[model samples]
Target: MAFLAQFRAAPNLLTMVRLFTIPFIVIEILDGNFGVAFALFILAGISDGFDGLLARWLDQKTTLGLYLDPIADKLLLSTLFLVLTHVGIIPRYVTVLVFSRDFGILLIATLLFATHTLRDFRPSLFGKLNTLVQIVALLTILGEKAFSSHQFTTLNATLVRSIAFLAPLSAAQYAWIVIQRLHSAEDPPRRSAPKTGLAQISAVEGADPSGSTDRVAS
Candidate 1:
């Protein structure tokens, strides 16, 4: 489906705008301009939250929007984590652990999806907790650099270490839930919705090739 179908949707537009900010944020970080980067990061975060809320409020959820929103988020966070590691702000070991967890989950999800085992895409509790801490870690790093505060430095180190502990736990949590869902043999089978005679007639009449409801002479 064309993005134009949902290009006007406020939520999707915010998502697109968030993706667009990535490069500028990267530029700021590379140039040692943490202040501007922090500002931009906050902007992206706001857009992320606002987009979802606006989507619900406006009743404008589309398939494209549903997929696009998460892609944008993963791209932003993953890219920043990689870049921060590159610049020596985040520890290499922490980044390695984080990347491993992310890729492992992605791989499992892809395999399951390809095999048609699971259709519902839901976030696990630990997964959301991991994301929350990551956001805090990123903000702490940016704030430390931008403001040169001892408190920010301590907070950043704490958050990074917490992620080191939490990321893999979160990944395992997701894996466990997915495995349970896949092997739910005892669950009752899903029955298809009944299509009654009236529904069939209504469908045919509404989809008449001639596009006419009135009777016509032969």
Candidate 2:
């Protein structure tokens, strides 16, 4: 089902802009342009925040946006983590955990999508917190280099350790949720009717931008 009217919505446009900025951000970081890269990272985050808020405010959420937003986030963060590791900014072990958790979730999601066992991607709280911590960690690393702040050095260490633990736990949580879902599939359907638009929108609004949902967009 296509929502053509929402295709050109401001939020979707902002999301695309965020995706587009990824390559440039990577290039800046690679070239040792820490200040430039850090600024771009902030810009990307701002765009990310506004895109979802605008989607809801404008009442213009689209399935495309729902999927595109998270894809952009994962691509950018994952790519940055790898690049930063290459330059010895983020530790190799932390990068490994980040990639492992993301790929594990992606692999499961792919299997579910292939078998038609999953519908919308509901992001667990663990995944959202993991992503947030990862972002802060990235920013701290970038900012510390950009300004050589001793404070950021300590902050980066703490954030990296936080992500180290959170990443695997988040992956395990998603796996458990999927297992519960698969088991629940054996049960009979509910007597209640399908959800209404208002409820769907509310769920989407309240939903963290971590994964797909049970209901696709109208």
Across residues 2-118, which tens digit of lDDT does each residue of candidate 1 receive?
A: 668788888899999999999999999999999999999999999999999998999988887889998998889889998999999999999898889989988888887888877
Worst 10 residues of 1 by lDDT: 207-216
* TM-score for predicted model 1 compared with the true structure: 0.82
Candidate 2: segments with Cα more than 4 A from true spot: 1-7, 188-218
lDDT of 1 at 48: 92
Residues 8-102, model 2: lDDT tens digits: 88888999899999999889988999999999999999999999899889887888898888999999999999999999888899999989998
Q: What TM-score, over all chains together, does every model reach?
A: 0.82, 0.81
RMSD of 1: 11.2
